[model samples]
Target: MPQDRTLLYAGRGFEVAHVRLHAPQGPVWSDLYTVASPRVVFPIGRTRLDVRSGDDTWLTDALTAIRFGDATAYRLRPETAAVRHSLVVSGHASVGPTHGASTTGVSVCLMTPQALYRMHAARRQLPDTDGTQAATLVASLVAYLAGAPHQAPWHGAVARARQLLLSEGSGPGTRVLSLDELAEAVSRSPFHLARRFRQQTGLSLHQYRQHLRLASAMERLADGERDLAGLAHDLGYCSQSHLGAVFRQAVGVTLGDARRVLGPAGTGASASARI
Candidate 1:
């Protein structure tokens, strides 16, 4: 595997780096690395890698954020040839689990659509200075993650259902299956799937799908997509107006404002959106 990174910002007590990994045609293992300072990572782009910290393993992707504290040792083993992008924030001492401050292991959490959008926009802008601004952003993000509730491990049908939903619903052009379809695909009754899914992830099926659609919209808008009507249709919305309404309600900014800031060669415009 070949990996590269670029330092985007450096501050008094925190710094941000954009890291990328490129794997060969087959599975590969990276050299062991140890964390020297507390850090949080926001995964970007398409990602599929098993993070091994001691005997525990965690799967990380676009919808997940990972935190590692000082002295943590870990390695990456990619199951296939792929490219991955991530934002690594180091020097922040409070990036550990929300419940307590044991810095020896890893903490992974599901990122809400708004949180993911903020991270994606930040990566797109790639500010090279302004430590004060960077620190503020990092602190806001850490606090948001800390407040978000965590779920216990999910398995069996619930896990399979989640996998199907994320994989199929994340695309800009893919329409998510209906509840009946999803339940059948996951080998469970609709009622059973609905209850178990909520119990496992603390989100209804509809809510999770909405998150996927919104995340897709943010990613494309950040990439400079301008066709609101087409984008809405592709994402299974009734129309452009429908998408606009939901986007504003969830992100606290209009689509036009978001596009202006997250467009190609963004002007570094900041939004009042939730951090």
Candidate 2:
């Protein structure tokens, strides 16, 4: 089940969307620690909108604190057709239910690091915005979100666990995180720890581990530093054979095939394509 990426075309406007997504509820990250969704941004369009949350907070593009009043939308309408990436960071907040191929009509597309860098660099000529300068703010918001990281969390311990994985790679061995060990590190009992971790990350322990492992593997493959055997060891798989099964199943590509995504990477099929 992938997120919706269909571009909606109406009489006077259209939405170009792409981005990877995981809900606040689900085991989406059960495999290994997962990479936060990559950054995907939309260009600010012709109609600037004033978005407000139920809490009375003005919805800015994701960069600001999401309460910066009118500074959330960027007002830039370039004259030509140069492709640009705007960061998005709305919709990720607890919004509402979503289903099928129909667009739920929200904003924010988590972009990959590469996409973020590109968007920031584009700022050199295009200028910067919080979320309000545009006639249309969605693109501006997409820009604001493009370079940001997803740090939203209700509990500190779960975030601490994620930070550890981020700073130290996956685990002791490929597939090697135990609940008791994680609890010890986070200073909570196993049951309480697991519950909080799941609630914060929207994933089970096993799923989080697998997601982390795969993200690590993706990084290694991009660097052209390992074959199946080495990747397995680096990621703690039992052997190259075991690695093959999990790797393909997790990423939808064989180890050999993943190695080729290096140049231009993932076909520039913006994370928007996934949303």
Candidate 3:
């Protein structure tokens, strides 16, 4: 009489949770899976969303839907900066192109089912009174995905600085622009720009630059190329050991260890190997 829940994705730093509905006469499982990205967002027609995780409960009426965003858009921060939030889609829902919808508003990079379930339980006790429970849940999710208190404003020089970080390759990778050049490109005073970059992105210009460098390293490691030393030098590390120290301190693991774990799984084991 009820739909079946499922685990769509699981990784080192992310996980996607899902539930499929086959209303006796509704869409068939084949029709549902045939959609573009088997891993995508689904919209609710007239059904309700009833989520129950542990001690939490969240509900939503028709009109609530799910979608995806680019995980490559993630910003690097201190490991201690992670913020956890819960997502629960109520009622008939489906998948789309890619990514999953946490709240109708936020795009959560599925962390862990255990974590999601826990948050679901917490959400139940905090339903919205404005009749837009779905919106509330999603808003909370978006905030969490945004690095919480570190969510960069949509418009600001610092935000622009962060945009620069996530866009294309930089520093150790292919970005040829230097700090002063980018500051000039953004038309902000270097001193002021550095301060704002710190306030907004939660790191200095130099530090965020390292973030990009680290991201690039992770990508290389995931390739399973086995050129750790070459990858390090190419990514701007003074040497293999230099990259190893920074990578371990920032990513929580050694370059070799991450490569072995990811083994081409694309699980962000690369992220953990980055400097």
Candidate 4:
């Protein structure tokens, strides 16, 4: 059986897919995106991949990060991995890849292991709708790869507040924290925390939590879960209808439509499934 394609996060402007490919007898080519969207691919193993767009092709190794923009179409051919895990992001700002002297259209940049670890750590700390932090991390990674100046620093208090929020809302049966509680945890007044959080992450704490809830619900639904009421209750929505309203607003599609797109559980591959 193929490995499951898990959508780690998805929101209005960005989405992330965790892809694992099982044993391959030969180089495997997979269609990545049809529409023009900026994408970053981080291969988690010592594998070689050729990213192709039209006649332009770039070669990337496991440790390198590749960025592409204005690509009409793209495909990935992975070599030499029996089981490979890669994190791919779409719809973020496009940065040019570091290219070899001979290769054109793709740039390869060395990413430090520590930086990669911090990126994932920060991602795991963010609520689902808080794509801003994730995007920032990616952009920073790109800048670092391109030998550019880093972005402004995140305030220490706000960073701690974000971690506290993530701890509260990330696990199963976890309850979200009230703004007052979060503020107290970070030693800030609620008003101050809210203001700083918005400035740092581009979303209020409440909005971020809601995005996390909706994202959790969407993952369950995509995994072939039924019982909307149970999902709503588990995720702390007031009611099933409330979940539906929020889902439609955040996803720009009805739950039914999303389910259809996701297909029947255990039978269909996710939209981001590796071919």
Candidate 5:
């Protein structure tokens, strides 16, 4: 079995990963991922996926899109078949999948599967384009995936606050606003805003900001940014060690291990490939 993982796009409240696994009548492959927030998974080929958490298990068909809510630990196993898949992880405020569609806190949606396959093809063709074009395509796709209809009131103050945080938390050099500042902007008391924010979004403001910073760091790392100290400083970390500690805690892997698994950064031509 030969497997590869690539970072396709990372911005603000979300990041997408392209993963390929080639297992031809080989041993079953399983991996554990720490899910801090909601994520959606799309299998590109005819492959079976078994997702488990503790006693809960879900068997999914090929080419189906699955959305999972905040899970502490998740185990993913693939059948004895080759497969290529895309996974998108986003902050809680962006995509929240309710239960009943699948297992608890997991939702299954099937809308425009053809469009998704076309997007996958476009990602394969992205390497041929310039950096600006690739970035734009990625952003567009992310926006589409995150563009689920709002289940809550659109004009609600909490919604506006969430949007403000998401917009400001994207990219590097972001400084999370204070509680007072956020409350003032949203015209709510600090305590009320904090409580409402947490109620609406599964994550607190500080936790959401950390998630964004980590996502940005992952993108820079994939683009061949290797200077840990510089990357830390750019991300507004006090020091490289601080960034390392947070990465290890949140991702369950050290920076060195991630770099080794990702291999060297590829040229734009090698950005996308099949198993």
Candidate 6:
């Protein structure tokens, strides 16, 4: 696979890089790779990473970020063909202990647009920041994610249903599914699916779908998507203004502001496109 990684800044105890991983033409899974230092990775846009750690495997998309301790080894396969972008921060002092690490010292966190916005702002300042300020900004994000709430476990039909939503949601043309449609796909009654989905994910199907739609919109905007109308339509919004309304409600910024501040300066956008 062809890859491009550019070092954006290197401060005293920390460094930041923008990495782009293109889809491979041959084998689906790439060869194993190891991290020499503790680092946190934020996936952008429609990026989909299927991570293999030890005997376990899981997927990380626009809705998630992953942290790995020194010497951690893993393999990756792209779940989508879109070129994946990620922001990598390494050599931060907060590397001592990270939240939600499994036996391999790799932890996954669910990310929000607000969190991503904060990170993007910090990252955009790296070039002008002194080493101390740089480390502080990057470590702040790590600390914030460390304190976030853990996800409730989802199993059986609920798990499958969640996957279906994520898979369908993380793309250019997102497919909307009603409760009945999702229930049918998961082979469960509508009531059972709805009730169990909320029980496991703490969100109704409608709410979760909305979360995904907004996430997808954020991902695209961060990737320098300027066509509000096109983006809104592709993500199932009624119109550009409708997307702006919900975006402001959820992200606390107008679409134009988000684009100017968060989109494609150097760092990858937040996770949600893959959520």
For candidate 1, the lDDT comes to 0.72
The CA lDDT of each predicted structure is 0.72, 0.39, 0.42, 0.56, 0.56, 0.69
Preferred candidate (lDDT higher): 3 or 4: 4
Candidate 3: list runs displaced more than 4 Å: 1-104, 107-147, 163-176, 265-275
**lDDT minimum window of 10 residues, candidate 6:** 266-275
87-107: candidate 6 lDDT, tens digit per residue: 888887765235555676677
Q: In model 2, where is the ten-residue run with the lowest total lDDT?
A: 62-71
Give one digit per residue, the lDDT tens place, for model 3 in 1-275: 24465543333223344444544433222121111232323321223333322222222212112233222111211112222111333221232212333322223222221222223222222221221332333344433433423121245676465556544343355655677877887889888888877664456667666645665565455345588888887877778899888777776666676556433542322222231
Best by TM-score: 1
- lDDT-wise, the better of 4 and 6 is 6
What is candidate 5's TM-score against the reference? Answer: 0.45
> So what's the TM-score on candidate 6?
0.80
Q: What is the C-alpha lDDT profile of model 2 across 1-275, one tens digit per residue? A: 12333232111132223332223323221222221332233322111122222222111221212111111322222222322222233333322112210121223222333332233222221222221222133354343543444323223677556544443454334344467877788888889878976664456777666655665565455435546687787677778778778766655556665554432243323222221
How well does each candidate superpose onto the true structure, as a TM-score? 0.82, 0.43, 0.45, 0.47, 0.45, 0.80
* Model 3 per-residue lDDT at 70: 26
Give candidate 5 misplaced runs (Cα > 4 Å).
1-155, 169-175, 263-275
Candidate 5, residues 1-275, lDDT tens digits: the string is 35677776555446666767665653353666666777766545445555666566554433345666777466666654656455454552445464334345555443232234334434444434443445454455444544432122224666567556655643255657788998999999999988976675455778656755665565455445778888788878888899889887776666654444332443344433310
Name model 2 segments beyond 4 Å from true.
1-151, 171-177, 263-275
RMSD of each: 3.2, 14.9, 15.9, 14.9, 17.5, 5.0
Instruction: Kindly indicate the candidate among 5 and 6 with the higher lDDT.
Output: 6
**Whole-model alpha-carbon lDDT for candidate 2:** 0.39
lDDT of 4 by residue, 179-255 (tens): 88888888999999999877755567776666555555655664567777887787777777888888777666666
